[model samples]
Target chain A: MSKTLISARGLRKSYGKRNSKFEALRGVTLNIHEGESVAIIGKSGSGKSTLMHLLALLDKPTRGEITLNGHPTARLRAHKLNTIRNKKFGFVFQSFFMNANDTVLNNVILPLKIAGVGYRERHRRAVSALKTVDLDDKRNNKASDLSGGQKQRVCIARAIVNDPKVIFADEPTGNLDSATGEKIINLLFKLNREKGITLIIVTHDQDLANKCERQINIKDGRIVSDTSADAEQDDDGDEEIREIIAESEEDDDEDATPDKFEGDNNIDGMLDQKHPVHHINIDEDEEDL
Target chain B: MKFLDIIRDANANLLRNKLRSFLTILAIFIGSFSIISTSAIQAGVNNFIDQQVDSYGGEGYLAVVSKDSFDALEGLTGAMGNGNSTPIEYKEDKIQDGMTPITNEQLDKIKKIDGIDGDSLVEQKSLNISYVSSKKTDKKYLIGAEALPPGNIKVETTTSGQLDLQGDEYQIQLEKKYVDVLGYTEENIIGEKIQLVVVDQFKHTQKTFNVKVVGVIAPGVISMGYSYVNNKTADDIYTENTKYYPAEYKDHVVAIAVNYDYKNHSAKEIKDKLEDIGLSAMTIDDIIGSIKTFFDVILTVFKIFGFIALLAAAIGIINTLFMSVQERTREIGLDKALGMSSARVFLSFSIEAISLGFWGSVFGITVSMILGNIANNIFHAEGGFLESFPSFNLATYTIKDIIIVTVLIMFISFLAGTLPARRAASKNPIDALRYE
Candidate 1:
């Protein structure tokens, strides 16, 4: 609940030639609050992934205005964008895209490495991030050898290694089993609560979308809907959000209402007893890894 | 950021692809090998040539007649080029009494000529040589090679007993080993009393002096590339005693040293003028040129061999460069995408090619030297080559050839880098990246 951290307006992306131009994203505007847990959900190819990619600075927009923190990314140089991405953004992919040659610790520590942190310090920081995903024991193991779920956990650890302000997950649970998917979802929301880290995910699964505090849906190349999960508890800060995802059942043109992901902050009831945490810190600054 | 780190990392990368690097460097090794080995052999040949030429002083040299020497040798040899060129026999023919009447007047005039630095009219008075060594009884097939004044014989073989003592008509460079002897070895047994027999216009033996053993000479000393060499013809024939017919012989030969003033006129200029005065002038060039047709054949054979080696090395270099480009495809793409110019890539590979050639040359040179030495040791060139026939000095190239070889190698390196450097510059960034 603070000033907007990101605001996108008139974003667009297209592929192919003029006559057969396949538009990935059309003009869309949205605002995201500080430390907000937001998920954009729709059926596959509804411009959800393109939205995430644009927000993540992985690719430039064909035509758009996207402001992160406060600066416009309309024409930032590749090196400058890489610097911002390294210092402020993190990503987790459905395929668990970790470099096979690197150890679990090294994969987690890459962002900080790109940020030019010292070797000893990066190692120490990466170890701590590994602990976050309960994968400290597998620190020296090569990322390539990890199981599917374990690989996802390693990716989660890497996303948080540099203490990034924004963590983006593009179909984070698409490859995991049902039980593993629930665990990962629980972990994402836990970080949003305890550490006040911003979270954004692009998913086609409606069940996964219902778990987030807010959902922004896209149809064709345009935003079709944006709303909370709880229709009546939009005012009270303690609004309960149980998973209400209807992902694969949605149509391209269906209007999506935002899903409420927050629960009562004082009880910690919704979370498993296994989860552990401390005071929340939502500072705009980042800690060096 | 760190220079040493960059080289270390590059070196490690090179080590990772050991086979590729070795194959690449092998081209250089072969190229340098060809250049170096050939040069070493050339050096050996030149060294041998120098030993032969060293005995003749410098370049090619000769002394001959255009007309006649005496009735026996009249026109038995080739002429000195022109129809009326000076005959060298006249210089000796014109000399009578104790003075060269025509030469004293032209001594300064000869000096004023364009390429004539100095000249000597030599007289060799053959004395019956005696060995004082008690082990000898009328033995030794050697003569004290004696001559007079600035007049000297070209003693190609230093082992010969060419006496170096002071004597009128006897300035000899005796082989150091045969100094003082009062008798003869069995080889020279006409008589034991080694003395000079002086005679007048009448047929008579003016046996004046019983010469002490001031000198003796070894027989085998002439095997060092000599035009006029002898090994004790006959002790009695040249003794200070008898002759088949009576005559007062005052004949001499001319030995001229040509001035190295190559920029000015030639010695042939004065040689032409010498004929009018009944004199002759011959140069080392004429002597060396007489056998030039033979040398041309040798040069043609060596050139073909050297060309083959050089061509093979070039092909090796081209192969290495192409492979290197293939291996670094992704790296090249990354560099290009990151703003590296193709020219820089070309330059880098060019340097590599040049270095490869250089190291190859070095190795080749070394191997050649070893080969040369082995060959020399195995087939010792008996001193007969120069001593027997027309032998040329082979050391120290004409300076022109030295410059030629240097320019040749540099040009070869440039040629070797040709295709490789171009291929490196021809890579496309997008295509190369997609090569994975």
Candidate 2:
């Protein structure tokens, strides 16, 4: 497994009356691996989104520490935080909060723009990103003119355009129709698979949670079940997995691109398993040659 | 962010409310324009006064009131009585034994004074008479006369036979206007022909002297001050007003030219000195009563106008800036979040106001120039009072006008922007982000 890139210990956020502090995240702790795809699952007010915000350094913890890529985040200056946010993190909110006044092309180029990207190169990258979302023809269309689903897709393009190390989505499908939501999820995972970029998503949808290799269920900001799909059941031997499985050297092809084995290599309902050894072997084979 | 982005974004935002922006700029333009125009006109008046004074030789000489000089006689009728009063209803038929005349000795004494450049003595015959030709004409008194002084005063009379006033000065240099008109009344008046009957109370001289109309001398805008009068003792006593002397007539009115080299000086010093010598001197400033007084009435009217216009312009600026603040609330929030200080926000808005003011002043000045020129030409064509004298020129050019207008506009804009910019900058980023 990759080293932990971010860790939040006892993170909490509260809102409301002076005497009544309605804690959003009550002592939440979570770890995101360097390149892992992790999904946080819970019903409404489960503190999943709050936890994501804390992890992304978008919110400060009221009573705890949030360390991002190994550096403590609470004491960071605003300029330094902005720089880190610009270069390291990308966001895909549920509503795809696009600036309604600008064209799709401008929206796609906004992050690069805030980074002071040159006009020509910025447009070129923006166009390429739009093409990736299959919305290149609509690049000049105002964001207000786009449908809910199309806007979300464009937002995803904007997020990945910077080639950031982590893409954090807060209920990436909360606003879209069922089919469109599924499409966005598929697109997100596909891009994650292709780029080996970390994807941290928080969602209430069980179907979405079923797809990620690791699932964390937050019950009152405490991670009640942080079980991996096949983690030897923490010495108690329990997994929803009918089967279990998964998984650098910068060179020598040891951590090279995971090649396609050219077969019906499907890993579905793989979260249920008795022993995780056999799936672990497949991960090892997937590692190098 | 790139500089271009900031410019383009600002332009785009400003475009959303074009009327507001234009009105803002218009306020600036009018404000700056009025200021420059007002200043230029003030400059014009100053220039005019200076030109009028300078055109008549220099400013050192004063018109004084010596008890025996001719001006004292005229000024004594000023309702302000002379030192110790005796109304001289008529000229003294004879030089009284006790009477003081400004004599040649006094002139010589003045010549001995350290700074006496020169002097001129004057006599005047201010009486009116009538003449009937085949028709008739109004009896115009000698419209103008030069009171010649001592031979040492160097009276330059342009009379017949080249009788140099330096060598053989005459009684008067009469204008040919009288002789030329005499031809209509009498016959063959040009040369060796006509005579004028000279009469002025106790005086009737009908001796037909040869009409030596040597030259027509008219005092123009620039005339030399070398004219002088011969001593009264030099003239033969020919019974009051019937004498044609070989030397210039004794006008018995003295003018002392004090040698002052400075442009601006205390006239009181010279006056006090003259007063010690039993002469009363009044400076140019005393005569004109300070150039600033000429502006009192006009300035009062103009200041009221300027005040009202400036107030309106200020309102325009404040309104536009407040709108800008409201429109760019989120953008300002974003900037603040990016660690921009409130002062930077203030500076940006203030600079924008200055820019608006700057352009307006340029336009205003252009209007003033074009309009001022048109006014001058029209007034001159109509033979108006301003046209009769001359113009005060303080011409400005493209570079100079631009620089001046820009500065004025920006300064006023800076003044106008203060409250608005402060209000905008004071908003907290958190509230501003949530602001509509």
Candidate 3:
């Protein structure tokens, strides 16, 4: 099985202090493996964004710990955290945050600039990233002058410019029309499949959640349902079998329906076996049943 | 972020709101202009005074007088313009007319003092010359001439050679005005002889002494338009004028010019020693120090105004930067979220302030220099106030003052920037992103 890129256990997050304190996340336990496209599905205020923030190392958890590549991130200094965020992770926000007055190429160059890349090399990398998004022609155009879809594409270019290992997208298509959103979704999955980059997307859209290999539904800061646990018993035995299935699935690439449900099934099964506590937490939160 | 990137971004940010930045820089320019202009003017005045001091017998030379005579001179000047002031009472011990002579005992003590160059001592005797004439013109002109002091004395001259202090030949450095009146141009008069007639007071008999013209003196406030003569010529002329007086009165010296070891002892130290011997001494600074003090007072007042303007400019920097911080809240949040450190954000803002100061001071210095040069040219031209003093510059810019002003203004800008920079650094990325 692929190595776990990020693992969290009993993570909790809160805001304010004492009487006015509020809990954003009670406890979330999950493991995201390398190259897996996982969707964290939830409504607003469900703490899915908070979980993503902790998993991406953009913030510190109030309780418990998160380990990136088996190193406990809680003990790392702020500077180290910033370096990790800059080098190892990418982010695509829903609002498409950008320096609007700057050129599109400059917006994409932000992450590489922060990493202290040389000017010529960073420019080269930014142009290549923009090419990947098919927006290289707009390199010199002001970011504000672009359409909403183009702006999101430019934001995606900025996200991947530093060659990050993981891309945490906070509602990547939240502001787009369905037609443009589908194109963005296709591009994200294409990068995941081609470059082997792990994708952790936080979204409420059911259609988008179903497109990923695994869907973890968060309700009131607790994971209520995770589809990966149902096939836990077949994890070790199914790796070789799943590879055969994956090979055959690649043959019928145009048939999107069957591939969506069955793709990477064994990979999800491996998750529940290693982390029994995550399964137990889901069982305990199933009081509605 | 790299430091260069932070600085570039800072300058770029300033351009985003060009009008506001320009106005802030304008305020800073006002303060810098006034300050640097004053410093330049002060430097120019000091340069002119230093030249004057060098011409008047230099740093080591002092004019020594008996303490009583010095005090009586001060009293006489003080008693003027006030009719109510009492007249001096007669005293048997003190000289009645305030012209007390330096006794032979005091003269002996003066020569014995440490650091005093005994050979450099020359009594400042006023020679009563009847009139001066040159062979080119029969016209006799009234002229005042004194013996040149000892040591490295460089009298400002239009055209001249050094005066030989011990030369037996009588040498005179005639003033520019007398050069024309005696029918000799400055260039052609060198090596020529002029006649100085000294008439005895009692006998009314005259002895004409021929003195060679060595140099032409440039007009200066310190020289007072008086020509300088060599020691031999001055001694002969004094002897001829006072030949009939009592032999004891011949040595009644009121003042003497002397040189001392200026490198080993300060002028004040030597003055103190002279004071102990019942004598008073005035250094070159003591004589012309009032001019410097007057300029210093006026310059200091202008400098105070400059600082006050700077204080106001500092407040303007704070206000401008604060508004910038507020306007760029979301942009700052984006940078912070993208992993730009709090310190870097603070640095970027601080750099913006420094850039403002840098531009302001650069503009101030450039404009002031241009204006100063123009003023110098205008004043040095014909019919200008400074026309007579060709060697005097109205303004002088030194590299040290330029650096000092730039550094000081930038430092003040950084101090002013701290308030807004702290605000920017302390902003929470999440909250800042949420800001509209």
Clashing pairs in 3: none
- lDDT string for model 3 (B1-436, tens) is 7789878988998899999999999999999999999999999999888888776557788899999888777767768855454556668766568778888898898888899998889899897888999898999988898888765677888896878878999999888888888887889999999999887889999799989999999988688888899889999888887889977677789999899999999888999999998899988788789999999999999999999999999999999999999999988887777787888889999999999998899999999999999999999999989998999998999999999999999999999999999999888766786687
- Output the better candidate (2/3) by TM-score: 3
Per-residue CA lDDT of model 2 for B180-217, tens digit only, reads 55343212321232222234334454332222233332
TM-score of each: 0.50, 0.61, 0.89
Model 1: lDDT of residue B53: 45
Model 1 per-residue lDDT tens digits across residues B144-205: 33332232334453233343333333222333343335344333422233333245324553
Q: Rank all candidate structures by their lDDT, best first, as comma-separated numbers.
A: 3, 2, 1
User: What interface RMSD does each of the candidate structures achieve?
Assistant: 9.9, 10.1, 6.1
Off by over 4 Å in 3: A230-289, B55-57, B79-89, B199-204, B244-249
Provide candidate 2's TM-score on chain A.
0.77
List the lowest-lDDT window of 10 residues for candidate 3 chain B: B81-90
| Ranked candidates, highest DockQ first | 3, 2, 1
lDDT of 1 at B96: 34
Worst 10 residues of 2 chain A by lDDT: A280-289
Candidates 2 and 3 compared: the better one by DockQ is: 3
